[model samples]
Target chain A: AQSVTQLDSHVSVSEGTPVLLRCNYSSSYSPSLFWYVQHPNKGLQLLLKYTSAATLVKGINGFEAEFKKSETSFHLTKPSAHMSDAAEYFCVVSDRNGNEKLTFGTGTRLTIIP
Target chain B: GAGVSQTPSNKVTEKGKYVELRCDPISGHTALYWYRQSLGQGPEFLIYFQGTGAADDSGLPNDRFFAVRPEGSVSTLKIQRTERGDSAVYLCASSLMVGGRDEQFFGPGTRLTVL
Candidate 1:
């Protein structure tokens, strides 16, 4: 079984400040990790994914995440926050093989205060 | 190129009514999936299809939930005897191929509210 846990349900950050969203995961196999962002009334958008390649993965919109095997975590970060960055972010996990089902975390809602 | 599209952006039904949600995947994508998101929670996997056959459906809550992809391009999620607990957003996603290596694009989702 594979699962993801997003540490913060809601994260508030000021514009121009660095943003951090913590996530931990558990998987029986070589896990594939992904971060998806959902704007209000919009579809889920793929930010980044880690498939056992480089520990550091870069995504769209200036977002990035590091895959730390030792910590069983894949935390998302941004160098600076923007008003458009405010969205519900979900950390997802899946088996790297044929199990195409994506197990998602409860999600972290990012709120940017201008 | 178009992204995934789902119809009936919002649905309201009484208890025990049957409902069907449609999804039109991106053109030429071979893999399709269904998921459900409840209030204050993440999207939960429901089923997936590779071509016209179901690839996995272990996430389905019960017999009340069923899905089908008739021609391998469009899919539908059918729910029978709906309950208030079934109220949630039904999402459809599709990928280019049949493996986890591909990225899945999601649809805007159909919000189902069971009354």
Candidate 2:
């Protein structure tokens, strides 16, 4: 079975400060991971994904995550937080072996303080 | 269209009524997926369709929920006797299936409220 866990339920960062939201995963096969953000009342948007090619993946809005096999972690980070960054973030995992259905973590709600 | 699209941005229904949500995947994409997101929770997998066939549906909560992709592009999720607990945002996504990367682009979602 494939599953994902977002280590933090909530994370708050002041504007212009660094931000971090941690995630972990478990998969039987080589895993494909992704980070997505959902702004209030809007569609979920893809931030980035790791398909086993590059350990570090960069995404929209100056976000990035490193795929750490040894740690079973795929943590999302940003150099600076903006007020618009306040939203819900999800960590998803899918393996090549099955139908590639995504397994999602509960989610981490990020709060940006001005 | 460039991205996935879903209809009925919001729906309010009485308990036990039936509802149908629609999704239009990105053009030329062969894989489509359905998910449901409750308040404060991440989206949960509901089903997957490869072309015109349902490849996986293990995540469906019960038989009351069903989905179909008739022509391999537009899909509809059907619900029977909707309950209050069934209220959620139904999300649809499509994958290009390029090199098996499986990165899915999502739709705005159909918010269903069962009262």
Q: Who wins the DockQ comparison?
A: 1
Off by over 4 Å in 2: A97-99
Question: Per-residue lDDT tens digits of candidate 2, residues B22-107?
Answer: 99999999999999999888899999998999988998999999999999999999999999999999999998763377568899
Task: Tell me the deviation in Å of residue A4 in model 2.
Answer: 1.3
Write one digit per residue (lDDT tens) for candidate 1, span A1-114. Answer: 888999999999999999999999999998999999999999999999998889999999999999999999999999999999999999999986533999999999999999
* Colliding residue pairs in candidate 1: none
Per-candidate Cα RMSD to the true structure, in Å, reads 1.1, 1.6
TM-score of 1: 0.98
lDDT tens digits, residue span A32-71, model 2: 8999898887878889988878899999999999999999
What DockQ score does model 1 reach against the true complex?
0.71
Candidate 1 residue B114 C-alpha distance from true site, Å: 0.7
Each candidate structure's count of clashing pairs: 0, 0
- Model 1, span B13-101: residue lDDT tens: 99999999999999999999999999999999999999999988998999999999989999999999999999999999999887648
